[model samples]
Target: MSVPTRQASPAAPPPASVLPAVPVEPSPDPEAHLGLRFPEGFGWGAATSAYQIEGAAREDGRGPSVWDTFAYTPGRVANGDTGDTAADHYRRYAEDLDLIRDLGLRSYRFSISWPRVQPDGRGAINQRGLDFYRRLVDGLLERGISPMATLFHWDTPQALQDDAGWANRDTAYRFADYATAVFEALGESVPVWLTINEPKTVVQNGYITGHHAPGIRDEPTAYLVGHHLALAHGLGVQALRATGSASRIGGALNLHPCYAADDSPATSDAVRLYDGYENRFYLDPMFKGHYPEDVLADQGPGSPLVRGIRDGDLEIIKQPIDILAVQYYTPIYVTTDGGTVQKWPTTQAAWQQVYPPGMYDILTRVTRDYAPPSITVTENGLPCADEVGVDGSVDDAGRISFLRDHLAEAHRAIADGAPLESYHVWSLMDNFEWEVGYDQRWGLIYVDYPTQRRILKRSAAWYRRVISDNSL
Candidate 1:
């Protein structure tokens, strides 16, 4: 791989009034100064992915996923930690559901384990696996909590990987097959279905940086996988419509709003390409039915990503979705040389730059530009080095403060006409944190991995109050 030559595209330039001498946090709106309430009926929820929380790996006829294979390889994960028994959510889901009810959460967002449901990713429904989700959803409804289930969340079945996985276009259709199976089994019992979670993570971390499962540092192949993921998203949506279940389906994307480091012609192109790669690569195809021209040019005409795209693929990727799950974790400042500069303080996860305003910018941008019918902050929270104190309690003021600031910004976004409807913190409880493993905790409830005891942190107590009051 070599330096990508910059190319200008039709991406909208920042309004002259909005661009500042240097990118800084936007000042609070006049009403935000006094604080506002999250609208009544707005969903307050918590999110957890199957690989991160549901343990029970190799149990009940469940097959292996790519993450399992990767974690088993030495030097792949921190402290040799794996999701073998993460939080024990698979066996303790009832306890977790009770925790959500105790916290006054209106919704619970979780991902279905693909390998658990369809062991090979293509055939044979696992009755035992499907029963787990059936019970989980029933329990949520019984507790008066809405269930939003994501079909795929970074844990691709290892069987699929052996056949080229997301790098192969066929996997997109295969995903629809998997989606249909889930829909037929769960039906409208699961009201919301997210096709995929954070396709960008697969391209950037898994393939580009080799930091995630099925790790590979191949840019050409990574972008190819990105395309397939988008295709899978569309196929999943189409699959749901084909069933005529009247249930809503959408894609979960992690958007990073990019800003120019300086007011220079050279920096402008850098910002365009960076934004194209980080945001538009997924957004444009989903909402606009095309790839960003600058992004296409940067890869050159003969790249694998270009050749992989066939006639009408973009149309398939542009299916109308009922809602969009926008996961905002950070912002990026692009320089003339196509590198990034940190403009805000970071969390325990160094990549997560803590600028609450970025949440507002991204939500508003997506609303103003793509105009998705509705949006939800599916995954947003701060990772802290939290622990249980001697008093049998955990005090994580940082996580509380982080959630409050971001929720304020989110409420501001809704008032500013962003059409944002719901907000979810990243994890319901501490679990496996991917490559960094169990080192950094990002949960309102602390999970003692050894005893698997769930302790409500100060943040959980504060969030419970916020949820009950429906305000900041």
Candidate 2:
């Protein structure tokens, strides 16, 4: 993509000065010291979303999701790739669970497909769909792996999208109903429940950028969608509590900490707007019970983005959560011109910059700003174009280094009193990646797409050792 040239703005009244940068504690890497160790019983896990791994998109009475519609459209996904037959985990979850156990991971975090359970996004539940998850949970327990289930991972049922999707307040209510139905079925066995996963991505990629499912490029719709997602989160939490299950519930957010390219006031102002939209827009409501005022003003008072917010929505969105699941991959560095600064290195995903200090910055910032719940580093990993080696093994040294650096930062965050309990890598195995499809690989274990054979990468061996020693 080519960068657009910026034109000069007419001289006018200056906007308000930006807020001061929030202070955060920094912890040195523990790897520098030989005796360092993570807290005892610190949870170790690997995570995968349903659409990304669980294939069988049209099987077992599963209805279509927006992703299905999006991927099927030509030119939407790279190389015409889709998740129709991802890793075939739906037919091979038992073997996948065994792989997780073999990795010495104590926890396995996977998402339940909304369309799989409640095929239409509402109404009667599908027994076959629920049975799949029941078996998955039981299998995890059988292997001594705790189960963490995320309810929605941007797979909004197509039927719901036809009815205005998340822009409609009714969709939030539908989500609560769906959440309740799932909880009544599997909440007893699944110890942890993440109501929604990375809703920010849904609003930005799915709506604003038109890169993901139900692709629409409307800013007003994006805000409305984001608001409804937050409301759905609160209602989902309430539904879980109503089930009377002992499951802990929360929502996962992919937060990108923003920094100024320079110390100039203009750069700081750019960072302020970027941070407000990227981070605080979600954080403030979940933690502070209101949207960031600057972001609202940025959207303009007369914009439809501010019009959909009805009374009592924020109250519902402020529901207390037991934990805050965080998915951190990179940070944003904005210049005075409001364009991103390409000062850092990147991963296979070009947008993902290689910055370890971001882990510490995000963790401590959330700790100080939103003290409502414990923290979990739910998704963090590097994507590499991995291939099988001559010796029938995959050597992904880049991923191993990525994990070591990020895990070191995670350990430092814990030492700095971030209240982070668990850290789950982005994936257990490579499957489908949205938009870019299968081009990017972000798994400890590599899967041969043609054969569906799983091969443990060098990073997997290193991760297993870290899990075993509870240290880097």
Best by lDDT: 1
Backbone clashes in candidate 1 total 0
TM-score, one value per model: 0.93, 0.93
lDDT per residue, candidate 2, 127-245, as tens digits? 89999999999999999999999999888999999998987789899999988888988767898899888877877777776777888877677887888899899899889888788
Which residue pairs collide, candidate 2? none
Error of 1 at 239 (Å): 0.4
Please write out the lDDT profile of model 1 over residues 1-472, one tens digit for every residue.
0001111121222312222122222234211323467787999999999988989998998899999999999999989999999889999999999999999999899999999999999889898999999999999999999999999988899999999888989899989998998899999988888998988888877777677878887877888899999999988988999999988888998887889989999999888888898899999999999999988998888988899999999999999999999988878887777777666776666666778899999999999999999898898887777878999999887777677788888988999999888899987888898887888788889999989999999889888888888888
Model 2: residues >4 Å from true position, as ranges?
A: 1-35
The clash tally of candidate 2 reads 0
Off by over 4 Å in 1: 1-34
C-alpha-based local distance difference test score of model 2: 0.82
Task: Report RMSD for candidate 2.
Answer: 5.8
Model 2 residue 322 CA deviation (Å) reads 0.5
